[model samples]
Target: MIRKTSLIAVGVVAALGISLWGGSAMAQGDSYTIKFGNVISAGDTQNQGYALFADLVKERSDGRIKVQVYPDSQLGGEREMIEATQFGDIEMTAPSVGVLANFDKSLEVFDFPFIFEDAETAYKVLDSELGDEMLAGLQNSGLIALGWGENGFRNLAMVKGTVKTPDEMKGIKLRTMQVPMHIAYWRSIGAAPTPMPFPEVFTSLQQGVVDGVENPYELLYSAKFTEPAHYLTETRHIYDPEVILISKDFFEGLSAEDQKIIQGAADEMVAKIRSLKATISDEIRAKIVAAGGTVTDLTDAERQQWIDSAIPFYKENASKVDTEKLKAILEAAGNTTYLEAIQ
Candidate 1:
């Protein structure tokens, strides 16, 4: 009887071992790798912020997941990358919200010329109910908007001359991202807004295909947009948003735990990127000045001129965008000027 009991116990232990091994195999099989790609140059604030995301995911997953980052347009421009993510060919991409608005016009509200006056105001709106509602629009486009990142306030840099006032921008050729509102805004102000990829701007400026490009101080320094466009204008005319977008298909495929892990990491990285940008404006503008390029800050009156000039633009393009959505944003601004929403 003792021998028979011992044999039964051994059989139970053997079954348990097989079950545990099968469970391990199942867990391994369920793991999926994600590729995170961006157009930003490596080591810039965007990439530094993105690194924080990668580290968080690895720590959270304990190595069950991997996020591979491809920077510097090694894959393609923001538009191309977004398409890749949509089709699930690539897992993720973050484009400046300007290009992203093309995929989902609801985001064009962010494209509103001079919508955000400061990052704090932007943060309040972006982190609030308004931002969440806007982000939800991405699901239909096959994108999961992870979190907001920073592109900061955009300033104009020109190869031709320093623009100290609205009049100075007249007849000047400027390069803008491929966004309609931005192009229209510049056109209204009498500057030719050329649309192209971030990578191609340097060559376009070098070849004199375009006279100027506009971006925040950080991008101007990192992308070397200032070298080709020697005159820097702190126009800050358009306040744009940069966003981190993950493929909805891939994100939805992950377990709920993994989904939270991926999103939580991006949330944490936004503050870091914003903090880094906050401290760099003066220093970056100074660096450009030290290099013998002219850096001009618009006077308060000059700044208002840029703002007032957008009135005609809004009248024309606001209808061109979704009127219902525009009403929501306008209502958010208290039915005042679009500038009120950001300020």
Candidate 2:
């Protein structure tokens, strides 16, 4: 009778152990670590926003999901990180729409110069049904688009002097991203566009390898390009909006609750980024002048001329990518002149 009781007791304990182990294993399976990579520098508005996203995800998930952020190209350049995200090598990345245009040619519409006259107009198009369709289209490319983040506007920072008009841009060896449209636009305006990596920009400016570089004021000042290329123009030529992306495969594998947590956190992150960017350009513009850099604003006529200069580019490249999407964006932005011209 003792032996029988001992065997029954052992069976009860074994069953309890099995139940406890199964519960623990299920909990472990629910937890996930997400790796997010970007080229934005640490402590920049974008990274600060990303940090908030990580915190929110962790809090919302009750510590079941953790986001590990790698900024300043710690993972790699924007293009490299994007490919990594697509392949599930990294879970997330935010890349400028220009670089990402290479992946989804439909995005090339945003890369066109002088497309958005102001941030408000850009936001209207981006938050519209049109934008949702574009974001949804990324699933075909193995990416889950979270939302649009700001890169502000692109302005010319020249070593020689302020370039207030397209005529002034003539023959200037300007540093450009290796993006074909940007290069083509610069060339059409008579500037010799020198395509090179971001790391080499400062040295190129200092050594006279390139006469100037173009980026937003924040990037120009933060990279110290303003020190070398002191002439800053408010070209506002390109309203760069970065897209936050996640790996489609990895995202699909997550629990539906976890997916909701990520999407909620990402929406908040994008809002934070846009809010920070609203005043960042003015703040950075002041800083550039304080450090003895020249900031030039285009007059009414000059701004008009700049807009007209892009007419030729629009005529040449409109049909090359997504013409319908391009037409839609131009029409939505109240650029009827460009819309008519392209048609």
Question: Where in model 2 is the C-alpha error above 4 Å?
Answer: 1-29
Report the Cα lDDT for candidate 1. Answer: 0.76
Q: For model 1, what is the alpha-carbon lDDT of residue 51?
A: 84
- Candidate 1 lDDT over 131-183, as tens digits, reads 77777777779777877888889988888777777667777778888998888
Q: Which candidate has the highest lDDT of all?
A: 2
Go through the candidates in order and give the clash count of each: 0, 0
TM-scores of the candidates in the order shown:
0.87, 0.90
- Model 2, 1-343: lDDT tens digits are 0123323543454434322221332222377789999877787899999999999999998998999999878898888988999887899999998888888888888888988889999999999888877677677788878888888999999998888889888899999887778988999989899998777888999999999999888888888898889998898999989999988666655544566688889999989998999999889888888888889898999998899999998999888879999999999999887899889
